[model samples]
Target: MYKDVNNGELRKGDVGKSITVAGWVSRRRDHGNLIFIDLRDRSGLLQVVFNPKISSSAHKNAQMLRGEWVIQVSGDVVQRIKGSENPDLPTGDIELSADKLVVISRSKTPPFEVDDDLNIDDLTRLKYRFIDLRRPKMQALLKLRHDVTRTIWNYLSNQGFIQVETPILIKSTPEGARDYLVPSRLHKGQFYALPQSPQQLKQMLMVSGVERYFQIAHCFRDEDLRADRQPEHTQLDLEMSFVHQEDVVNLVEALFSTIVKEVRPTNSLSEPFIRISYDEAMERFGTDKPDVRFGLELNSITDIVSNLGINVFNKTLESGGTIRSLVLPGCGYFVRKQTDELIELAKSNGGKGLVFISIDNEINSIEKLSYENYRSPIKKLLSVEAVKSISNVTNAKPGDLIVIVADDYKVANNVLSNLRTEMGKRLKLYDTSEFSFVWVDNFPLFEWDDKESAWSAMHHVFSAPKQEDLEYLETDPGKVRAELYDLVCNGHEIGSGSIRIHDRRTQTRVFNVIGYTKKDIDERFRHLLDAFDYGAPPHGGMGLGLDRLIMILGGEDNIREVIAFPKTQAASDPLFDAPSFLGKSQIDELGILFKPTD
Candidate 1:
């Protein structure tokens, strides 16, 4: 055994007991005849002292110790002097009196200190991730992740959910993002693609009569990367048989509610988890995944500003566009430069421009308001009555700035959603410590793909349309609502799911609606469609992003912090140097060829 007890297991109660401990030397200080070192293991740190009076050999050995040198020590646990105890540590009240020391392994100076929380660069940290993981902060995050997963497994197991493992390689059918395809060595010119999600297999599990199934599933996507996204990821993939829309939602709600209470007791969670329709979420917050912890809700001001002789508003209304405004409190004093930046922000988010009406002075009533009370470029074009109407609709106060966007409904809401969240961040509007979970349901079953001149499944082809909306499948697909739902937290979409089309008829109809030909359906989704024939029960479920969930719980802004090893924003791994060129022999073995570069 490496030690009788872990370094962190030492305590005042264990004083005077002889024990052995092994760990990396966190820090070492040499006093004249004595040496002190903090030994760190997976559990935590413990202070070990080497004195000539205790053992001259051990004292001499400790003198050669340096940071990150792995060593094992036989010592007696002793209580520290009253004034010398470190209250910051749990084992601070006690110290180890070392009588012997063994240098198990030596280490060179690390690229960065593990004991200090320095602002290290991402490349350096990732390249030297082995050392970075030694930090206490990183260790705690790893433990928190473990606790969360363990809690999930226990909770779901108790709920009669069976743990199932699915295949890593799956058939390549369009989910949304491109797939990371693996070339088949034995089969000429054929390939196997990594699973984006176990979407079909879990549904197949339901067909196979696994009443309830779950997996900590691995998924891959060859797509652009961001702080919250990666080339590969994990999700809590689950499906339930004999279930409806609410049954799946209720199960996920209960699972997350239990996780938050057990793993993150300090963070405040709203009870009953607020539910909103897809339309309501997009109208009020401008996004289906809204951070409801703070309110800067979007309000439609087209009715108020219509026919006011303002060319911007009138022209927008004339072209079937909508005008929406959101109030930014206390930003009424923004200078020309600040407002111009906001205009650029709007333009970047696919809006023509933004119109700002800054309320400069206080007014008790609409009758008391005047032209001079508000500041806008178009103030000369508006009467005091028009301004008051706009203000009343958006509930703008004396010190609020009303930012209005005039564009098509889709572009207008998209722009405002970005602006709302950006301003919320700059103004520190929402409490970072609070988590707001919302369930947005009733998404459209199909969206028109202008480029393809055809209809596309809004969530996925497997999603079932509402029973009442089936009539519109052939006549008016846009009006058909699907049984899709999403689990969102603090403006990040954690997962999406829906009641699946379990029968072949509806499944075939969805395939046809999405522009898939009969031959295409028989070729691509033949296995799933064929399985539905044998006896697929009414089933539905969700796949929650495991990394995003942990990132939120750990109070981290980037998902990379929660992930042990993650690719850079450009989807490159610095440590392994992946995406490298393959040798000629290897490429030829896989029957692959590459074009010559200039």
Candidate 2:
């Protein structure tokens, strides 16, 4: 028996009681005569002292202990000596005096320290995930994920949502990215692609009269990765039969409000999460996912600056484009180099250029003009009304910098959104301790794909078009809005869902709008179309990315940190050596081939 009480459970009251404890040696300090060890388990750190007077044999064994060595110790819990307590730890007030020690297992010196802040290289951490997960931070995050999932399960079950499993190997109707295919040995040329999401299946569940359904579904997509993206991920797949957009929104609001209060008590979540329309979010914050913790909002100055004689402003306004500006508080002292960098960032994000106005009296050195050199060279040429309107609209005061971009709405929003997030990070404007959750709804039904010269689903083809916008689905697909909603927090989109198209006519119209040929549509969606034939219900649901949501809740910048065995950014599993080549015979049997040519 290696344990009666956990190392972290003892306190000053448990002094003089003998007990057994076991865990890895988190830290060891030798003082010649006495040795102090901090033993760590998933619970927390416990200070254990080995003294020669108590047990010479245990003291001798403890002397050989080093960092991360696995061992078991029988000890008497004792209060720590005065003035030496670690107020940060739960078991700081007490120490364990070792009477017996056993070395359960030995470990090699780790490549990096595990019980410290996450400052290790990413690849190394992924390669040694076993060691990394042993850290208290990782353990706590995993526990938090578990608690969140368990809470959702209990909450949904009580709400009469049935838990169901969906098939992983499904025919690919690729939704947003390239499908990850699995070559079949039985069917030589045919491949089964991993489910992107349980999108179609959950809708089918609704058609089958499952009043409500939920699953922790595994989804896969072969796509470029980002800080919050992975090749394979998990989402909370939920659907309810005969529900409106508001119903789903209310349900999610209640579920998450409860989860945050119970799971992330530090964050103050709004009772009813803030809701904004898609266009409204883009107009106000320059992005659909706005970090509402700060005041750097993107305000429109198109009407104000429309008459400005500047060529860029004139051409953009004449071409039916918009002009916007972001006010960086107290950044008016920017030098030419800083302004150039902000311009370069704008150009890189597909904007024509950027115009910066330092409201401060800092004179432009290159222009070498007096303190009256205007806010900028371009501002010097503009009407006073334009300048005053921009200042008044954006609330830019002295010592503030107003960064302006004029282009098509999409390009202007793209450039300013990137700049807004970057500036917020650089200026340390966001309160790290705060969590702001908003629901962005009414997304565009279709987005233009210039290369393909066609319009495709903005959320997904399954999403139902807004009833008011249905008239424009065929006439002007770009004008149609979908009843989609996204849960966004801290400038990152947590997840999205929508009221799905349930009828054959609506689904077929969506297919046509996305330029899917009749033959292709019949081949791929025949079953789903057939299900709709069997009396599909009016269904709407949402799938929140568990990893990204947990990442935000855990105060992590990357989703990989929250996942236990996440693959590298390139979609290669370092720990298990996955994406590895198969044997020749096995590969031949599956009819897989490797060829490269241009």
Candidate 3:
């Protein structure tokens, strides 16, 4: 170690002690005869002063140094002059009086400033991630991520969970997201897929009598990218035998609550996180992962408009549709142009258009026609009584604007849901400091795949069907629910898990229900089925996206900030320029062929 005394630890108490320190030059200020240099290392920064009277050679060498030059100095710690002390830094009260200086390495000026407050594009930052990581903000985030991982490891270890290493190469199953495949050298026309979540392997581990297992595993999926998503990501994958939905939920709640308290003491977490069924969430918030930070919830107004003569409402109800609306507080003064833009926003999200109605300031009675200020063309078709009834259902008050969507159930809900989220941002209704966690349970086991012309697993095929809905698996697949749970915080899904089917018979039944033939099931998951024969215990597991969790903890909108070597949205690394072409001999040995097309 190059001088163990950290920059931050050198304080007034060590004023008279001689010490050696090593770090990069953060800044250098020369005042004719005296020079002050701020030295920075991972721990922190400290100010070092050298005067020609103390050591003429050292002072001359320090004057020639530039920013980011790695150097070593032998010095005596001394308190700074009272008037010159800086309170912002931990070691601000002390200064190192250097007698000797040794330049260990020289560095060229960086393309971008390595300061925390510097504003640089993500592409440029990623290209020079090595230097970027030197900044205080990135260093803190990386350290916090490490602490979170360690917390999970310690917590699981104490709970009797064994850390198990799962294979990176596995067989690809035809379900869920697209797979990232690797060519197999020994077998022609065969490929090995990267593990998506260690889902199958964890389940098999439980079947093999590994009662509890966990892994900080890397998962790969060849899917379209988003700000929070990556082609490859890390998950705290864990599984436990003889566990049910409640058990899994309890374990997760304990772990997360503990993590929040230790890792982010300032953040407030909801004790016993709110539980809402999938249907309830869709009904109230219009989305499975609902952000509970505000109260502008969607309310059904279908009953009020079913018999109203409004063309928008009548035509929608006639075609098997429903009407829903969200009332924005104190937005009645929005100009015509603003209303039109909101209407277009709703249309873009699959609605015919939005009906903007404002409460009239003068009249407050249901029978008064003068009490309605409407922006939609269909307003003339609605009577005073219909407007009052709709307003009553939405709890609208004077100066409150009600935006309505009338169309198919899914379309109306989705359109208004997006509007609610967007309007919240425009209205400044979201509280960034507040964290609202909710558990969305009772999800549909299968969803109809339009392109495939069959039903597919909503979570996964192995997720067990709810006990009460088992009889409806074949008779009424749509009514059946799965034992699935999602831990959502502020509109993002941070983690998800489910009680899995440990019995081979139940597993096969699920595969069949999803249109998987026996041959296909046997070929894809034969190893898992074979393991269950000896005596498989009922098991379940959940995987938390580590990068996403760190992003949330760091108050960052993108996961790239928390990830050390994150790939871009295109899934390419700019720093190393990866995914490049390989030699033909290497491809040939992997039993692969490449053909270029013009």
Writing each residue's lDDT as its tens digit, candidate 1 over 94-141 gives 999999999999999999999656899999999998998899888888
* Best candidate (score: TM-score): 1
What C-alpha lDDT values do all the predictions have? Answer: 0.91, 0.88, 0.87
lDDT of 1 at 202: 94
Cα lDDT of model 2 by residue, 162-260, tens digit: 999999999977557899998888999899999999898999999999989999999999998988899999999999999999999999888988888
RMSD of each: 1.3, 3.0, 1.9
Separate clash counts for every candidate: 0, 0, 0
- TM-score for all predictions? 0.98, 0.95, 0.96
Model 3, position 497, has a per-residue lDDT of 88
- Global lDDT for candidate 1? 0.91
The 10-residue segment of model 2 with minimum total lDDT is: 364-373
159-234, model 3: which lDDT tens digit per residue?
A: 9999999999989986778999999988888999998989989988898888989999999999988999999999
Assess candidate 2 and give its TM-score to the true structure.
0.95
The better-scoring model by TM-score among 2 and 3 is: 3
Q: Report the C-alpha displacement of residue 80, candidate 3, in angstroms.
A: 0.8
lDDT of 3: 0.87
Ranking by lDDT: 1, 2, 3
- Choose 2 or 3, whichever is better by lDDT: 2
Error of 3 at 561 (Å): 0.6
